[model samples]
Target: MPAPPPHSPTSEEDIRWMRRALHLAEQGQGAVEPNPMVGCVIVRDGQPIAEGFHQRFGGPHAERDAVANVPAGVSLAGTTWYVTLEPCCHTGKTPPCTEAVLAARPARVVVAMRDPFPKVDGGGLQQIRAAGIDVQVGVCQEQAEDLNAPYLKRVRSGRPWVIAKWAMTLDGRIATATGNSQWISGEASRAEVHRLRGRCDAVIVGGGTAEADNPTLNARPPGPRTPTRIVVSASGRLAVDSNLVQTIDQGPVQLFASADAAGLQPLVDAGVEVIQFDSDSPSDRLAMVLDHCGAANMTNVLVEGGGDLLGGLFDLDAIDEYHVFIAPRIVGGAAAVSPLGGQGRNKISDSPVFATPQVSRCGDDVYVTARRVSESPPKSVSFNP
Candidate 1:
């Protein structure tokens, strides 16, 4: 509506800028859970004049923030806007981003991927195109989708993306024969785990893990969001003095226990919401936990379950991603605990397969990341560009 800038119209340049937008989106990692992390970069004359990202939930969208970054007197009429996600056409917490873009009157818009949120699934692009503004999509689409995998999964499937994390020794032992386990991975890997918790809606674990580790599960240095701490137990046995229960005021704690389990008065009085499930089987209980998480609108779930609980989730094929941190040390003993426990797959073929793992180094630890091969979002909107 005001003044304008210019830029090269090459697809290669578009991709480079889109990647920049994607990088900006990462800034919203811990703050935007239910909402996808989106970033926008406005370029004029081959240079980025303004950029912004979805900073937090229920706040200004990336498009609005980016447009606001433009100097007060500058016009956006002829600029090319590169966004990691398609803007919205309908207003909810804030006005539709399409309204802002249309008012700014950008000459062309480049979107990395079409938004999958049903309310605006491709509608924003249609609205922009209808206004005679040129629109190009699918520029870094795979990257964009990867960045918002949890959000897309939740919106499309009504279930949170489940990520399982564990630390093990080279001997594949999670704990010593005595069940004493601590500091398996180096400091960096542990810190990364905290960062992972900050980005998720909840962190789930078996009751055994809750008692064994007595973990606080809060993000160190404090992230923008506090994830809910969940414990699943058939007997409803959580120590009232455990770190999770003692730190109730810092964050929310939830326990999924069997309907008949007892002696939870102290925990409930300490502000823990107890949800009862009818079944004692891990797979059945896991299903109920996920159902409750879905109903609560959770998008990403970080699982810190102990061996038996992890095994149950595996049996149910519930884990969507895996983060394994392998320490160089070897805690050798047949009696030592391994990463996965419970009834494992009878045959190798029945075991869940994952995409090729991504490996990285964290301090003295080797970190690996992989996702289930069977889990994928439904076909996305097709785009020619």
Candidate 2:
């Protein structure tokens, strides 16, 4: 099971300050992947003097940013520090955040939660305690965990958190008889999809969707980071003239295929990296792709594949979250494609149940998001950076 919120109930003032720090943490989204989004607030006399967030990967951490922002004349000797995550004790691209905190000489440190990274799991807290500074943990912890779900999952499970998304009609049809799926949702919903893509490390599609939609798969109104575009195919029949092949320079494109698949030379010649696996099973192939992603330290992966591909991931029980967009129009046809396709549940009771469903509106479309309910926490795994 996931660890319980550390420490006893904190004061309301602590919760309020931690909530503000979490909000600051959210500002680093779309820019800080592989690294957790963290925020820090330096408080003196119960009032915030300065605040900062982890702005980008391999740059200064939140603690350093906050400490640096403190006024030149103002001393940090007696101030209190509120941070969304525990400060780092190990150095990677930057120095240890514990060094900064020790140098700042804060009287007390309040953290929303502990860092799950193996190297810094409890090392950060230990360092501060050793320095004779008071540390209070677990204030607004659940909110902080939700904010950094992708990062936490990546560290604990050794794989990217997968988000399965689709846009369908009220009747649950993703496409008509002829597979013409243009404009299922309104303009606003499509824009929201672009924003979603901006936050993920990669966007994946099946060969069928790639062949049909010819999507550019780039985030519109461009985000801080460019997500890699991936196409999974068993036959390896991607067209060289397709938009993905033509725009290789705009963003990274990767093709995952089975060994001995046909017509791959054209794609390879077009500068697409072809990754081959021995397994032909959809579930097995998906596992290999996820392993590849995990090795690359990708924190969030968005799956926008067609019905069959989505069904395969569902069968494997690999998806962590679902984003469904429901349009008002009804496309009635027996041959139409629904959201999920392969080997559906045998009984209604056998279907997977989701938790904490959130519903909202995007113009004329209704957007729903929910996480897959799990009986136990993900098995802990080690991922060395």
Candidate 3:
């Protein structure tokens, strides 16, 4: 019930090791969706002896990897172990990592933050301490949370963390007045979008985008796995010949539409999975789609929209991150669509706010990344040790 300590200062050595762990975790970015990216470092006499990071889902955890790879005959008996996230204690796809730590018999453990999942919560920390190893948590907490935001969000809420991405011209138009939006961003920025797609569990779009672009939505320069392609529409009418519909044999392609919508049989016959939601409101429809994705254990979603879909998500406050690319060219037209289109906010206070705006250049385009400031922080589980 007491308030947490006021950002306790960390030692220089501890800070260095924690940052190393974070860098290791970043290497697993594209491969560890639906699971938290964790990294571990085993230190003896203030020097690192072994290091490891979670490589992929259902693979050995960071602690296990590090402990297993400790050089033969090098003892970890009195060493300290540093990890970005708390070691898991429960048995899932692999054995509990706590067992490995206990066997190593480390003198102490340093964790950036406690695991937020209810099942593991403080249980991992408790198990470590119960074996007589000292544990210190909340070191480099903010950076660690930033790295695992998607995993924390997915575990705390049923829905995956949503990122809405798009590119527009200087005049705020994603396309010309005639809906010709191909190549709005430069080749570098488009390649960056493909990299983003490779990191998410699913890439979502509106039916209009599918019909207009007929994109493959596959991760180019592909990594471990391709993201699932999802299309949302109220009418459930999609072009049967679109690349998304025609490539069902390669990967997952799903349709989320209203129950009353018609003309979905052809997609089903073409091997597309059609899910019907009973909501008429766009906000409700978005929520239903997210719920279905969550139930299927998707941890991160990318919304590459067609204006209306992005607008609905914004109006409903459903997006967590934004990756907007601004091209150098200008195309002015009253009929051209903006990145988001819906009922405009009536008051300045009603507008959505984002924080930590990071701007970078991708060739001729300016890329901006920001996080929603209104969403509550992920829940944390802790106990005095």
Candidate with maximal lDDT:
2
TM-score of 2: 0.93
Which parts of model 1 are misplaced by more than 4 Å?
A: 1-10, 347-350, 374-385
Task: Write model 3 residue lDDT over 178-293, tens digit each, in one string.
Answer: 99888889999999998999888899999899888888887887756678899998888577898988777767999988887788898889888999988677778889999888
Give the Å shift of residue 316 in candidate 2.
1.0
Ranking by lDDT: 2, 1, 3
Residue 27, candidate 3: Cα error in Å is 1.1
Tens-place lDDT per residue, model 2, 1-385, is 2232334346777777888889999999878889999999999887999999999998889999887788888888878899999999997999999999999888889998899899999999988888778888777776787788888888988889999999999999999999999989999999999999988889999999999999988898787778889999988857899999899997889999988998898888889999998786778899999889888889989999799889998888888899999999999999998988888888999888877799999999999999976666433322111
**Residue-wise lDDT of candidate 1 within 1-385, one digit each (tens)?**
3322342344668878988999999999878767889999999988988999999999999999998899879889988999999999888888999999999988999988888788999999988887878888778887788888888778877888999999999999889998988989999999999889887889998999998889998888677778899999889978889999999888999998888888988889889999989776667778889888987989888998799888888777778899999999998888999988878889998887877899999999999999877545434534333
Score every model by TM-score: 0.92, 0.93, 0.94
Clashes of 2: 0
